[model samples]
Target: MLKPTIISLLMASQLVFSQKKPATTYKYGYNGMELIVKNNKETIIVSTFNSKKAIKDEIALKIYDMYTKKLFVNGDLLTISGNEAKVIGKVSIRKKGNLVLLDFYYDEIQWKTGLVEAYED
Candidate 1:
């Protein structure tokens, strides 16, 4: 009886200490663009972004151009990282009439994709 009780206590301690917690998610949106950050721990964080702008803002246009050049021409995945998080992902661009849409994916699970209305520049 004492041996069985000891074994059960050890098993409970192991179960409590060996479990990993799920990651926390955060999101930010600006001018039809959305950014997501997932933090699994203090050292491991991932980020992804999606943009579907009307080409109205200069900053948005510049970011779109950079992503287009990098993803389409270089065939490379974009890396967006900071002091708190690090993200490596792919960008997909599509055009419908005059509007351009950008979709970013940081894994098979986290991503966003769509189209937006176009505006005269």
Candidate 2:
């Protein structure tokens, strides 16, 4: 009985240590303001001026991250190709900060769907 108990404890510890944490991917868009996300696959309008222009001309974007709750990006802060990126889509929060502190890739796909389409596939 004692031997079996010891083995179970050791196995449990290994399992805990071996498991890896999940990552959070954020999607961002610009409407009147820049919006941040922690997931993907979303649609949004950027700014009132652009929103009134047309659908195809609107801004479409996605942000990928490991773990992030709040994203800080704006015309003065963050821009796409020198131009300002507006937020007009889905935004998700995170529990911890992994992508922010870690060496991860930030894929700014579909900044403007009319110009280019940013998809997972």
Query: Which candidate has the highest TM-score of all?
Result: 1
10, model 1: CA deviation in Å?
34
Task: Flag regions of model 2 displaced more than 4 Å.
Answer: 29-121
What tens digits encode model 1's per-residue C-alpha lDDT throughout 18-77? 975444343322233443222342221112242213211332333354653553532356
How many clashes (backbone atoms < 3 Å, residues ≥3 apart in a chain or on different chains) does model 2 have?
A: 21
Candidate 1 TM-score, C-alpha based: 0.32
Displacement of residue 24 (Cα, Å) in model 1 is 11
What is the C-alpha local distance difference test score of each model? 0.41, 0.33
Badly placed stretches (over 4 Å) of model 1 are 1-65, 68-75, 108-121
Tens digits of per-residue lDDT, candidate 2, 1-121, equal: 9999999999999999997544223444223433333335432322222222233132323233212323543222232331333333333322243322111122333333333323121
TM-score of each: 0.32, 0.26
